[model samples]
Target: MNKSEILNTIHELLKNIAPEMDPTLLGQEENIREALNIDSYDALQFIVALCEKLKIDIPEQDYGKTATIKSLLTYLEKKII
Candidate 1:
């Protein structure tokens, strides 16, 4: 999938997980935590959901390296497809 597709999928997932999150405000360079007001548990939940939905096992530390939407999409693109 392309970057925009990946981002849109993740954005929808985030919206589903946290309705308060505004996906439109999330830019390629925005940190998930700071941009979405998510905590560690929230991130973990998102990771789990992603794994279940996308059928990929992303390491917990992966999120640490994926501080932005673009980086996260890049990581998923590599690990998933």
Candidate 2:
């Protein structure tokens, strides 16, 4: 999928995880955990949800590389490509 599509999917996943979160308030480069107040458990849930929904396997070692929306986008883009 394209970057826009990937971003949209991520937004949807985030919304499912944090209904109170305002998508517009999410900074592309900001750390999602800090920005959304997501704890480690919630972050793990998000990653699992993303993997299930997108059919992608995000290695545990690479989780830190996707700390922000921009980084996640780049990671997914590379995987998709």
Candidate 3:
């Protein structure tokens, strides 16, 4: 998948965890968990959703690499392509 597709997938997964979240207002450098005010469990749920939906593996150690919108997109782009 491409970056746009990856971003859309991220938005979809994020909505599942925080329905109130507005993807448009999310900054590329913003922290997703903090933006959505979600807890660790919710964060993991989002990550798991991304992994399952994208059919990619994001090990626990690399979770930090996905801390922001840009980072996650960058990370996903690399993995997806």
Overlapping backbone residue pairs in candidate 2 total: 0
The local distance difference test score of model 1 is 0.79
RMSD, model 1, all Cα superposed? 1.6
Whichever of 1 and 2 has more TM-score, that candidate is: 2
For all predicted structures, in order, the TM-scores are 0.84, 0.93, 0.95
lDDT order of candidates, top first = 2, 3, 1
* Candidate 3 C-alpha lDDT tens digits along 4-24: 878888888888889987865
Best by lDDT: 2
Q: Write the per-residue lDDT of candidate 1 for residues 1-81, one digit (tens) a residue.
A: 676777778888899867976876877787877878888888888888888877888876676756788788888899766
Q: Which parts of model 3 have CA positions greater than 4 angstroms off?
A: none
Which is the winner by lDDT between candidate 1 and candidate 2?
2
Task: Please provide the root mean square deviation of candidate 3 (C-alpha atoms, Å).
Answer: 0.8
Span of 10 residues, lowest total lDDT, candidate 1: 59-68
Predict model 3's lDDT versus the native. 0.86
| Cα RMSD (angstroms) for every candidate in the order listed | 1.6, 1.0, 0.8
